[model samples]
Target: MVDLLRKSEAFISQLSLVAIVDDQIVGYILFSKIYIVDDQGNRTPSIALAPVAVLPQFQKQGIGTQLIERGLSDARVLNFKSAVVLGHPTYYPKFGFVKAEKWSIKAPFDVPSEAFMAIELVENTLQGIAGTVEYPKEFQEVS
Candidate 1:
């Protein structure tokens, strides 16, 4: 989280959000600009949700879910076509997320097909798109 904050210039700042609790920042979620390349080599703009966190004491109070909802909603208002997340398959589905493989989208790194998910902000936005996601350098640093 420190690295992401240190590098939050340019695009990341526009997509990051914090969840406040009693004047304290109890949770955070960030979305970064990403692209999905089609077989014909066309790149489509999208967003990637990563590192959503709520303090351990705040867990199970729906704070994390609120953060995700707000972030994704902000992404849509910013005109993002879709948003992707490499998280729990079952947990993310409640937010209308489905397997990225169903839309031919691929994750940047190796992970189980089920754990990778995507939600279309606009209908048919992901149609025919298939390629690896490109994350920011900060993500690779934590890997």
Candidate 2:
């Protein structure tokens, strides 16, 4: 998935981040551009936090949490309105993610509501936003 995004989404590189220790990559996270398409076909821009990973040796060491915190901080600096993620219902909430359904936002595929979450980078950025998230074609290819 990272390879696919690298090949197709130019800006993805800017949002792609990694954790390094002892001159080795230990973790990674990517924040890719996605959209929320409303009934009238209006597409509101957003980010998708996906494909986050930490080497087995790095697990339980806070590397994933650091990656997520840094990624979200970068996205906010980029002026992104919000971000969506299909992740642990318990884990993501630590970073302020709540069920997308709270704002009428949804995933393109069926997912447990608690697992599909969204976070507002800018205060109230998603207040009135409502639609189904449209991930890039690369995601479809993998799925």
Candidate 3:
């Protein structure tokens, strides 16, 4: 993950939000650059929430929620239009992610429709956006 981030440094922007307990990192979430190609083949800028990890001991705490909520809020402030995530279907909805298929959005790789999700950070941000979600090329290497 770190290597991908390093290689994507040129085109990707990342927000690493950490949950610290007693001054030690206990949970982390990474939001990185992503895009959806239009019918015209133009790329619409977007973001993807990936590689979220919480220490085993921290699981089931609200740390993950805090990390996602805070990161999404910050992304909204930064004018990010939307975010895509491949994650647990049951867990991500709490953060406003719905099935990406609802928006005619899909991932480059085959995934369960329920496990791949998206959220519009700004009102009507995705009104006209529809296409396959493309992550940084670096992702394909690790994925």
Candidate number achieving the greatest lDDT relative to the actual structure = 2
List the candidate 3 regions with Cα displacement exceeding 4 Å.
Answer: 10-14
Off by over 4 Å in 2: none
The order by descending TM-score is 2, 3, 1
List the candidates' TM-scores in order.
Answer: 0.88, 0.96, 0.92
lDDT of model 2, residue 97: 97
Clashes of each: 0, 0, 0
What's the TM for model 2? 0.96
Decoy 1 TM-score against native: 0.88
- In the range 103-132, model 2's lDDT, one tens digit per residue, is 999999999999999999999988888999
lDDT of each: 0.81, 0.91, 0.86
Q: Give the true-structure RMSD of model 3.
A: 1.7
In terms of lDDT, the poorest run of 10 residues in model 2 is: 6-15
lDDT of 3 by residue, 79-115 (tens): 8989999999999999899999888998988899999
Better of 1 and 3 by lDDT: 3
Worst 10 residues of 1 by lDDT: 1-10
